[model samples]
Target: MFAPGQEQLSKEQIKAGEIQASQTVRSAVAGAIMLYLSPFAVDFVKKFL
Candidate 1:
């Protein structure tokens, strides 16, 4: 069994870990979207002019 105050501390640790993971996912997705769009955007602009 966990010590008296350990359960609360464990919960906080789990929450912090989840938040960090979510932030990482968001950043990666944003970066990927930008990378994927850049080439298409440039091509479109080149053709439009």
Candidate 2:
């Protein structure tokens, strides 16, 4: 779906974007997992207090 002569992304460019997106998504999921489990971690610390 190109107009007269519009160029699409090259495979390398697309792959780079995909890798960057995946890395960002991975970090976000990791952060969410950490946040989800943080209360459990705090429980241990609370036991000493």
Question: Total clashing residue pairs per candidate?
Answer: 0, 0
Can you write out model 1's per-residue Cα lDDT over 10-35, one digit (the tens) per residue? 88888999999999999999999999
Q: Estimate each model's TM-score.
A: 0.64, 0.76
Among all windows of ten consecutive residues in candidate 1, which has the lowest summed lDDT? 1-10
Q: Name the runs in model 1 displaced over 4 angstroms.
A: 1-9, 44-49
Per lDDT, the best of the predicted structures is: 2
TM-score of 2: 0.76
Residues 1-49, model 2: lDDT tens digits: 4597878889999999999999999999999999999999899899978
